[model samples]
Structures are given as C-alpha cells and as structure tokens.
Target chain A: MIGKLNRNSTLLSSIISIILGMLVGAIAMLLSGYDPISAYGALFSSVFGSASDMGETLRTITPLIFAGLAVALAFRTGMFNIGVEGQLVIGSLAAAFVGLKLELPPVLHAIVALVVGALAGAIWALIPGLLKAIRGVHEVIVCIMMNWIALFLSNYMVGKVLSNNSDSTEKIHPSASIRVDFLTDMFDGARVHLGLILAILTTIFVYVLLFRTKLGYELRAVGLNPDASEYAGMSVKRNIILSMMISGGIAGLAGAVELLGTSEYLAINPSLPGTGFDGIAVALLGANTPIGVVLSSMLFGGLFNGGSNMQYVAEVPFEVIRIVFAAIILFVAANFVKQLGNRKNRKKKGEKASA
Target chain B: MLSTMTNLLETTILYSTPLILAALGGLFSERSGVINIGLEGLMTIGAFTSAVVAINTGSPWIGLLAGIVAGILLALIHAVATVTFNADQTVSGVAINFLAAGLAVYLVKALYDGAGQTPVVESKFTDLAIPVLKDIPLIGDPLFNTSPITYIALILVFVSYFVLYRTPFGMRLRAVGEHPHATETAGVSVVKMRYVAVLISGALAAIGGATLSTSIGSEFSATTVAGQGFIAIAALIFGKWKPFGVLGAAAFFGFSVALSLTGQVWGLTEYVPSEILTMLPYVLTILALAGFVGRANAPAAIGKLYERGSR
Candidate 1:
C-alpha cells in the first residue's frame, strides 16, 4: 500500500497527519471542558502577540535550533545521542564559568565562551562515543548514564563552587555577555539577540556539511550500513566518533546561546532542561533534516509558549503539552514502522519476481 | 559501631529491593528479545497506581496487585508497539515514558483538584519479624526483620535464576532471544514466549514501584521512582544481564545510595554537597558500563522485529 505512494504524496500525507493530530488535540481539549479555539488562539497570540512576545519566542527558538540540529545530525548518523541533555548542561556550565572569569572584548569573550561550551559538550559526548566504538557499548545506555552524571556534577559545581553562596552562578562578565542592543532597540526592549542569526547560520552550515560534503556522504553511508561502509573503505569507527563530536558541539553551542542570550547566569539544578530531549522528538518529526528541524523547533516552541497561556485560560494543566508532544511522537513512530513494513514487503515481492 | 553497621546494612537492603525487582523485570524482557526501555515508565505507573489504590482501599495487598496489573498494562503497550507494529523499541519506550508521565500527572490533577498529589494514606506495609530470628544481634533485625516484599524479592531472584537456566521454558526463552527463527523452527512459539516474558517483566517492575510507595514513602509523588528504573537497567547491564549478577549490581547501587544518605546523617561528609554523593550511582553506572564488566552482550534479536514473512 505504501509502496504506491510517491515521495511527494508521502510528504503531503505526513503534513495531513500533523493537521489531523492538532484536530485530535483540539477535540481532547473540548472533551475536557476547555475552549479549544480560545486556547489555540491564546497560544498563537502569546508567541506572536507583541514585539516582546516575538522576541521571547525567538530567544527560545535560538537554543532549540542548535539542540535540534545536534540531535538531528546524530540521528542521521544512526546514533541516538540521549546524552544531549547532559551535554547541554555541562556545556552551559562550562561557558558560564569561562564567561564569568574572562576579561576580553565582547565579541572575543563571547566566541571563546561558546567554543569552550562546544568543546565541553564534544568531550562529554566523546566518552559515550568511544565506549561504543572501542568497547562495543550501546550508546543509548552509556548516554543515559552519562546524562545523570553530568546533571549531578553540574549541580554540585554550581551549588558548591561557582555559586558565590547563591543558587546561581556569578553573572557573566560584561565582555562575555552577548548584547543585542541593536535588535532590542528595533523590537522595543525585546531579548532576541544576534544568537538567532548565528543559529540560522549554524543550521545552514549543518545542511551543507551533511549533504554537500564527501565527509557527510561517508558519515551517512556509515549510518545506513556500518558493514557496507566498511566494505566500501569508509572508516566507520572514525566517522562514528567524528559525528558524535559534531553532534555534541552543536548541542553545546545551544547551551552557550541559552546562557549568554537568555538566562545570563547558570542555575545549579539544570535538570534535563527539556530542550535536549525535546530535540529528539523535533528531529524525528523533522525527518532529521535541517529545514525540518527548524520548522519542528518552531512548532515545539510555540506549543511550549502557548501551553502556558492555555493553562491560564482553560485552567488545564500545562502538562497537556507534554501529552501532545508524546502523542505526536507515537504517531510519527507508528508511521516509521509502517514505512519499514512496506519496504520489507516490496523487497519480498522483488525477490519473488526475480526468482 | 554495631548500631552503625546494622543501620548501613538495613539501608542497603532497603535500597536494593526496588532495584532488584525492577532489574529482574528488565531481565525478563531483554532475555526474551524485547528491549524493555519502558521499564521505568511501567514502574512509575505501578508506583502511582498502587499508591492511589492502596490509599483508597486501605489494603496494601490490593495495592500491590493493582501496581502489578498497572505495570503489565503499560508493558502491553510496549509489547504491541514493538512486537506487533515493529516500531523502534527505544523511541516507543520513550513515548511510553512521556505518555505515562503526562497521563499520570493529568489524572492526578483532574482527580485531586490540582493538588498534584493524593492525600496521605493510613495503610502501609508493616515489616515482618521472624519470631526467634529477630532476637539475634546486629545482623538479625536488619536482615530478618523486614517487609514481606523483601523476602519475596529475594525468592524471586532465585526463582528467576532457576527459570532462566534450569527449565525447558528458560531454554526456549533464551533461544528465541538469541535466534527466533531457529527457536520457531524448533517448534517453540516465539511470540508467546516474548509476550509472557514482557508481561512478567512489567509485573515485577510494578511490584518494585509498589514496594516504594507502601514500604518506603507511604505516598505517591511524581519523583518517587526518580530514574530508579534507569538504575535497574544499568544494574542489568552491569551484572552482565544475568539474574544473580543483576541482583549484585542492584545491591552495589543500593549501597552507594545508602552510603550517601547515611553520610549525611552521620556527618561523615556533611561539608560536601549531598548532590555529589547522590550522583555516585549514576557515575558508577557510567564507569561500570564504560569498561569494568568488559563486553556486555545483548540478545541477537533484542530490538529487531520478528516478522515471520521477513527472516
């Protein structure tokens, strides 16, 4: 049944599925005695209501863009980097520590802090990658365990060492703070900074690197079939490590943007942050494409920003958004399974015909 | 010194119970070829359901049963997804986790009028003291005087070990996981074995949750299980997926947790932030997984779809 569906038609079907999912969500809201229209209206208004609201949405989207890209990149390489949450936390802490201690010009300080953050994330991700590559450890198990370590370690460091007797880290030095007075002025006191531009550039970079480069081809080939890639003379082990490092670096940059652009300080209890895990769902929904990740990030950001208002207006709990997200994941996963089934059936038919 | 030692031993046993139960649950699923990543979520559901039911019915026994049933139901979702739909086991497991969490929270709010918790219950599991055994010095109270669930869990460990190694059923379960087609060709029903194993996994995990609510906290909280499910998974791997090995790994993690909390009480490491000590289990998990156990082997068909028409 699915083999008959063209690529364009499948894409259309997926879009229709999303729309149908939203409708189902609306029905759920209505069944629960909430005004679905008003709730959705509040959601859209909250995200695009005013210049300030738009800025907040953009600020939120900035880090999501990087994190989503990070997760998507790893997914393309057939690695499930569940440690992105941990990587992001450690990266943020690393950048915040560097940002607070550094005394350089604003651009240089910011750049240095971001680089430190990315490096930290890369190093953090490398542990699991190395375990997978050399020791034959499953990345999922290692990454999940590493996330806990990162969370606890970062919490301890922020609480005991960098906290200055407070719950949060010392504020980043003036030089390290990425000021976006230009955009702020344009938006009349909005927090949207140059990080958005950087995020977009990073997305484009990821796109080109993944699709346009020989290295990207090799990485994708390794992801598709490690044995085949090895047969074709691709170094699967090196590609695996390189892909993970790049994945972690992107996620780490996300942490830097969140700290420097929005949070401006580090909190001791940076549990999960939701962005890293949410990135998994985002990447899945986006089909692990750069453009797909951006659009999916926007959808997720909107849901988060809107869910708050939905709670305010409908008196429904904000956790409804989590349900919605989970539902989408379930549907997408089911779709993937169905697609796999179709492919298997097609293969069998081809074999029979040849025989 | 005797009192401190007894306290430490008691704490270790207490912490190890849940880990052992959950890991034993995971053992069933993974050994049967299904990657039970939803173990955590199933445990959560079990914990919440058992707590709520126990509070309502004023029967710890009934609550325990309900917890097991709740866990089985959730595990069934995972079974259907991976077994029938052939969905990605990890993704489906994650989806189950998120869904269970959201559904549980939503139900709590809806039923409790947004209190985010159920009211405290009067009924809970009381520890069983072996009549003469409880009179022994030091080790007696900590070891002999405990909840019935502890003894049940210990018995389960032995039973599971025997089941996994001694029985024809055990042989078939392992065979299906290692080679489903071969098992099927040998006239064993692979699907039936997988279904049973996963269901058993769910029930055990749920019982673990029930133990937490009825024996430890006497109330259900969102963070009650708090990644204990993942700890069980680590314990399973750390123990090389063997039943007794998993039990030992669970005890090891339990010791770390017990030590951390005990350190706070004894003022041994009071100056150090308790969070660092709390993180010891996960840190240890990563380290153990990184190299200590050498190469961990998963079932050959462990997350792969077993389609009759395909392979």
Candidate 2:
C-alpha cells in the first residue's frame, strides 16, 4: 500500500513539476518587466476567447496529437525515434506529391494520399531502424543525419519537380483534401478540418493497439527488458523495426493531415516543421501514454496558438513560450533524477540490511 | 588549376576548423560517459555570446573567451542534471538544446531590442599570412595563411590526443567511462572526472561556435550554428571518437562543403544542382552510420548514470 502511495505521489510530483515549470516562466516574465498574470490571461483568451480561436487551437492540436502519439508509441517500445520530424517531412511531401499528381476519384484520392504519405514516413524511418538493428549504429545519430537529408530531399522535390516555378508545389487537388464543409461552417469558417476527428480516432486506435493487443505485450516486454524478452524467444530486431515503422507511419499521418487538411501544398522548408521536436516534450510530459499525450498535446497546442496573443497584448516575446516548454522538460527531468536517486538510496539500504 | 586546388584546400581547412573543435569537444564528454547532444545548443549560445561581447568589447579574443565561458555555464547545467540528479542524459540534452536556442533568442531580444540576431561585430578574426610560409609553393597559402582559430583548432587536436592518451587523468577518465565502479574503488571521483570532461567539451564546442561568429560568418544570427554541431557529432562517430580520426572526418565533411560551394564558383551550377550537392554530405553521413564505410564502437557506459556502491 505504501509503495502504491509512493507511486501516486510521484504522479502528483509530476503535476507539481509542471506547475513549477510555469512558475519559472512567470519568473522570467517578471524579470523581463512583463506582468505574468496579464500575459497568461492573454494566452488563455487567445485560445478560448472565441469559437474561431478554439478552431485554430484544434487545428494546431491535430498534428501535435499525431506527432505526440508517434513519440509515445516509440518511447514505450524503448526506441527514441528522433527522426519523427524527418519522417513527417517525407510523409508530407509524399502526400503532397500524390495529391497533386494523381487523378483518382475524390474519396479514394484522399485515402491514397494519406496512405502513401504514411508509407514514405515508414520508409524514411526504416533506414534508421535497420541501421540500428543491423549495423549497431546509434539511432540518434542516424536520425539526426536523416532529418537533414529529408529536409534537403523535400526541398529538392518541391523546388525541382513538383513546383510550378515557385518554391512551393502547386495547390493539391480538391479531391485529395480532408476539408469538411459542415465542420468548417460550425467553426465560423475557421481552418479546422476532418484531421481533428482522424487524430482523435488515431489516438483511440493507438491506445487499444498499445494496451489491449498481444503485439503490444511483446513490444512492452521487449522495452522493459530486451535480454529477457530475447530469452523468451521474442525477435528483438524485428520488433525494433516494427516499432520504428509504426512510429514513423503515425508521424507521417501528421504530415498528411497538415497538408491535406491545412496547407494543401508542399513548401520548400529550410527548417523542420518543429511539430516532431515538440512531440518529444509532449511525450515526456504525458508520461508516454495515449490519453496523457492527447491532454498534454492540447495544452501545448493552446500554448502555441495563444503565444501570439501573449506577444501582442503583454509585449512578451513568443520565444518565452519556447523557454517555458524547455523549463517544463527540464523540471520533469530533474524530478525524474531525484526519484532515481531515491530509488538508489532505497536499494542501497536494502542491500545493507540484507548484508 | 593549381589555384583552384589551393582554393579548395583553403576552404576545406576553414570549414573543418569548427567541426574539428566541436567533434573534439564531443569526444571528451562522451569519452567520460555523458552524451552531449546539446552541442548544437552550446554552439548557438557560444556564437551569440561571442558576437555580442566582440561588439561590446571590440576584441575578438575576449569574445572567444566569453563564448567558452557561456558554453561551460550551459554544460554545468547538463552535468548537474546528469551527474547529480541522474536524469536521463538524452532527454536532459534535448531540454538543454531547447533552453539554449530559446534563451539565446530571448537574450537577443532583451539586449538588442529584437529577436532573430545580434548586432554585427566590427572586429573579426581575419586571416593572416604566416611570416615565411605564405611565400612557399602550392601548400603555403592554403595551409598557413589562415585565422588564428584555425591554427588553435589544429593544434588542439594534437593537444587533446596527448592529454587523452598520455596523461594520468586521461587514463582515469577512460576508466570511469568504462568502469566507474572500479574507478571509485580505486579512490578516483567519477563525478569530478565527468564534470571536467563535460566542461572541457563545452569550452571546445563554444570555441567552435565563437569561430563561426567571429570569423566564418562575421556575425551571429539565429541560424548561425544551424546543424553544424550535429554534423560534428556525426563526424566524431565516423572518426571512431579519436582526435586524429575526428580531424580526418571533419576535413572530409569540410571537403564536401567546399565541393558544393565550388560547383557554383566554377560555373558548374547548371550541370549539377546545388541541392543535390548539399545533400551529399548528409547522405554520406547516413551511409557511414549504416556501416557502409566501417564501424565505430561507443564508450561502454556512454549513456549510463553511474551510481556509487552498485553492482
């Protein structure tokens, strides 16, 4: 019972860490001579003041949900897929390519574009996964390299081939769009689309696949103790590949959603979309859980969407929001470190008593 | 034709200086069992700090020192998180990276009343010809007629090789990375060694960043460091984490950069797309990482948190 209580306290402690993260940001605001209260007020008002505001927030949440789910799934499988951003760019480009090039029927066009986008993401992730499994290369290094490669590849594709003389590709066909007329009308002509529904359903599907399924058991088992799982006859290599592919596919879906539901064109991006990097913070804050990821992603989406208002009203730079996000990750990691220290002390005490 | 060859060599040398320094920095930290993925962030801070200071103090040398100090400050945060609190190294690294990028931009806004970049410094580390070497045949102009930072970067490679291989402290550093338990049993402080290694890494990486702002780019922008720090990390891995190997890998990467830049200068831009040329170095890095070239092993306890009195 005490052990269980201790675990609950740790969860509470994470909440406290989050609050502390906000406090740190507030302190920074104060140091910059900006009123924290008004800043936060503006932030909230921006995200929740109107239906259209909520629509914008939801639009931001759509991709974040997919990206966060991608990170969470991979984290649970004990692989840090830092290549999510790269995969996302690849996936978005693929979706854009298909959406622009293909002449499929309306319903079939959108589906095929999304599927192909996910396929491209999976293929991009497979390089790192296979390298890690077969060549003993660190996934982080490979992923970092691949991220740049993807950027360049996407830039090249958008500039040389798909582009209609501009740096961005031609507008994707309307048939391949994920826009919903009723939803757009409901949001007062806001940019919200069917991607929100798709994101929520993907979250539910991911949760079920992670918890209710046998494959999840093997994956989780391998994550916990790969050596033990190997002894139990699990193919760790195959699972690593599969986990990365799934993670990449989900990240790819985020790209497709962003393209089909929002932009409808692929632009030559000099830098990453940053959604995938944001997903790391989301996964960390969410404790790598599906429901937790959705909640935390919503919070982050609001922060991002509302940052502009905070900037306009409070005269605080939008960069402060990024600092706050960093602080949150920092405090959480610090809390984790403290917990690790406690566990080590307890283990030492147990050993001493045994001796 | 000879001049073009010399020009390529000069460009390669200039480009490799920062990579060499940053890779050498990463070598020290990872060798001591802490992965410093925040190299990019550290470099950014360094670039920003050095540029701002150089503008204020009117001395590139002072700016260089300021950059090193800034790097050490950030590295100390990482060391505290990883060594004291025993946080996950990579996550901590990511956080540090984000913090640096954000903090640098925030500071730029605070100090300069704007974001995106710092004011340009008038004083930069310009290239100077060596007394006698500049007059020599083919090699002199490229090899010796360079900025002081280039010389420092090259000399430091040997200096790091000596300190990391020949010194007693180096042995303990390697031992702690491989077997901290044994090192602790031998009365060496694992935490202190790790702190020293991490701090050194920060200093060198900062120097690399300072070199960029002070000489290479002549100013500090939000994208000044870009992905060079990561490329340095890849170079370090490709070099098998050795000082001389890092020098070679940095040069190789530098050569690729020079080649891409040269294509346009040589009026071959229409023949080969600059984007394709730009993609070559990254593709090579991925291929090298996939063991298409060879293999390199990391330190045994590279990412592990050392706990005292544990099995």
Best by lDDT: 2
lDDT of each: 0.83, 0.88
What are the runs in model 1 whose C-alpha is more than 4 Å off? Answer: A1-6, A16-41, A164-166, A182-191, A336-355, B270-276
Candidate 2's TM-score reads 0.95
Candidate 1, A113-212: lDDT as tens digits: 9899999999999988898888777898888888888878887778777876578787888788776788998766878887799899999999999999
- lDDT digits (tens) for residues A5-78 of candidate 2: 96677667777777777787899888877789999999999998888888989998899899999988988878
Fraction of reference contacts reproduced per prediction?
A: 0.60, 0.63
Docking class of 1: medium
Worst lDDT run of 10 residues, candidate 1 chain A, spans A4-13
TM-score, cand. 1 vs. native? 0.92
Q: Give each prediction's DockQ, rounded to 2 decimals.
A: 0.59, 0.66
Q: Model 2 chain B: which ten-residue window has the lowest total lDDT?
A: B110-119
User: Which predicted model would earn the best DockQ?
Assistant: 2
> What fraction of the true interface contacts does model 2 reproduce?
0.63
lDDT score, residue A295, model 1? 90
Q: Once model 1 is optimally superposed onto the true structure by TM-score, how far is the C-alpha of residue A107 displaced, in angstroms?
A: 2.3
List candidate 2 segments past 4 Å from native. Answer: A1-7, A336-355, B267-271
